[model samples]
Target chain A: MTGMVAAFTATILAAGSTTLLLAVASLVVATILGMGAAFAKLSGNRLLRTIASAYTFVVRGIPDLVVMLLIYYSLPALLNQWIDAMGIDARVEFPPIVAGIATLGLIFGAYMTETFKTALQNIPKGQIEAAIAYGLTRRRMFVCIILPQLIRLALPGFTNNWLVLAKATALVSLIGLQDVMFRAKGAAEATGMPFTFYLIAAGFYLFVTVFSLILLALLARRFEIGLRELAP
Target chain B: MNWDVIAENLPLYAEGAKLTLLLAVVSLALSFVLAVPLAFLRNGRVPAVRYAVLGYTLVFRGTPLLVQLFLVYFGLAQFELIRASVFWPWLSSPMVCVLLTFVLNTTAYSTEIFAGGLRHIPVGEIEAARAYGMSRRAQAFRILIPGMLTRSLPLYGNEMIMMLHATALASTVTLLETTGVARRITLNYYIQFEPYVTAAAIYLTLTFVLVSGFQLIQRRWAGYLESRIG
Candidate 1:
């Protein structure tokens, strides 16, 4: 009995680590996609703006699970068709983990685009004008002026997105990613203690949430050091 | 690509959509009913009562809804006592379990949203009611609740849409909601794209309808508040 309990504990912990890795990797992908889309939407070009708008609209409209399932089951087939059309003899493999991350990244990218666009817009226009007046290049101006304020402005929304994304990692288990949820389901079946195993799974998620909340709070305070609110 | 498969499955999709709507609407209605009183408790004077409500919201909001669903659906049946209990019949049904989980999950979030709305009510408004010699019950029912609910409309609309999307999770437990129907179609046909894409489209339409409906409601109900600002 002790041996069986130990095995379950070990497997769940290992699976929890995988969940964390998936969430972080997807967050990175989402941040990059979101940043590009935000810039595209904010650009002067009408076509870019329209395309970006459509991307966010469509992606945000559908549920994340459906999107994940659609991508997981379809992408490989679609890729194979393209490969066949090209007369390539090689087959590309698409793993469930990759599908999970990509779909999550794509779906959350829409949300992050909105968050980033708002953050970018909230940057005082005069600061950019002043940076140009001071002869700073666009790159330097963004790094020195926009990035800091963007971090400050976007952190709250970013934290919210991160937390949601972390919880969303559980959905990847449905696509056979063998994350904590999958492990818990297995343990529950094996031990006939579904309540105990599922409770532990919830504990794993709650731990991540509470830990992230504390860390993000510290980060927020760090970024907010020089900031002061205007009197209401 | 398989137009034939999609066309043949249209009725199944419609039936699934109906179930999806039922799940979303019932759970949202139930959550609203539960959340109103809990929101009031959250805002009430006692620290213990407030903290109790906060803890419920924190746990529900912190964990994934999938976990909560599993805890109720699969986990609850693990106990011999529950299985032997009078409620086992209702608890054994996937539909009941899903609805119960969704209501609990949504009620937690809605309570917080409504509580925030309550806190945001201008203190002066409450004071004015008091100064007018309104009874406590009158002040609560006539003034406070309406003001909080109106202020909560936009956020609550968001929660409604979220609840709608969340019905997709019901598929995991063998409920034939929209996503479940899509999954079944895929299993039968061995074609992935058509059924899932159809599901996505259905969800998109529902989301659009909900958004427009909320906009109309917001225009009529919350219009005055925006007008004051402008």
Candidate 2:
């Protein structure tokens, strides 16, 4: 009995770690894509703005699982067809993790774009003008002026997005990723105690959520050091 | 593009779309009913009641809906007591289980949104009601509830859209919702892109409709605030 308990614990912990890693990796991808899309939406080019708007609209409209399944099953099929047409002696494959991350990153990237856009707009326009007037290089201006304020302004929305994204990692298990949900299902089947195993999985997610809330709250405070809340 | 497979499966997709809408609408309506009382309790003066509601929201919102669904569906069957109970038949049905999970999940979120709306009600409005010698019940019925609903319309609309998207999860538990039909087509035809794309298109249209519907409703319900600002 002890041995069985130990094995179950080990499996769940490892799977939990995988879920965390997938979430972090997908968040990094989402942040980058979101930043780029935000700039595109804000850019003067009409085509860029339209494309960015369409990206967010379509992504936000569809279900995450549907998108994930579409990418997971269709991308490789499309690639292999292209390979066959080219007479290449190779096949392309997408591991579940890769597909999971790509789908999530792409979906949440749309959300992050909205958050970043609002944050960017909230920054005083004069700050940018002042930076340009002072002859600061564009890169330096962004780094020294825009970036800090953007982080502070965007943190609340970022925290909300991150929490939602972390919870969304559970969907990856449906595609055969060995995340906590998948492992919990496995354990449930093996032990014939689905309730216990699933409850444990819920506990793991709850812990992550509570921990994140605390961590992000601290980060928000850290970013707010030089600012004061206006009286309501 | 497997046009033949898609054409043959059109009826199935339509049926699935109806089921999807059913699940989403039923769950959203039920959650709205459940959320109203819970939201009030969350803002109630009693510490224990407020905390209890808080605890419920925390657990439901913190954990993924899939886990909750699995726990209710597969986990409950593990118990002999539940199996022997009269409720077992209802609980055993996949549709019931999915609906139950969705209602619980959406209620948690909607509770918070509604509570926030209640909190944001201008203090002056409440004071005015009090000064007018309105009874507590009258103030609640005429002032508080309407204000919260109107103030929370936009957020509630968002929750409605989310519930629609979440109905796709019903496919996982053997319900032939839109995504379920898509999955079935993929299995049957050994073709992936067309079925899922069809489902996506259907979902996108639903989302667009919901957004436009909410915009009209918002203009109707919250237009006074807008006119004031303008």
Q: Per-candidate TM-score, first chain only?
A: 0.93, 0.94
Q: Model 1: per-residue lDDT, tens digit, A1-232?
A: 7788778978987898899999999999999999999999999999999999999988888888899988987666667778988999977666989998999899889989999999999999998999999999989998999999999999999999999999999999998899999999999999988888889899999999999999999999999876855423
| Model 1 error, position A139 (Å) | 1.1
Question: What does candidate 2's lDDT look like per residue over B86-111, in tens digits?
Answer: 99999999999999999999999999
Residue B151 lDDT in candidate 2: 87
Residue-level lDDT tens digits of model 2 in A25-56: 99999999999999999999999999999999
Candidate 2 versus the native: TM-score?
0.97
How close is chain A of candidate 2 to the true chain A, as a TM-score?
0.94
* Docking category of candidate 2: high
By lDDT, the best candidate is 2
Q: What local lDDT score does residue B115 receive in model 1, on the 0 to 100 scale?
A: 94
State each candidate's clash count.
0, 0
Q: How accurate is candidate 2 locally (lDDT)?
A: 0.93
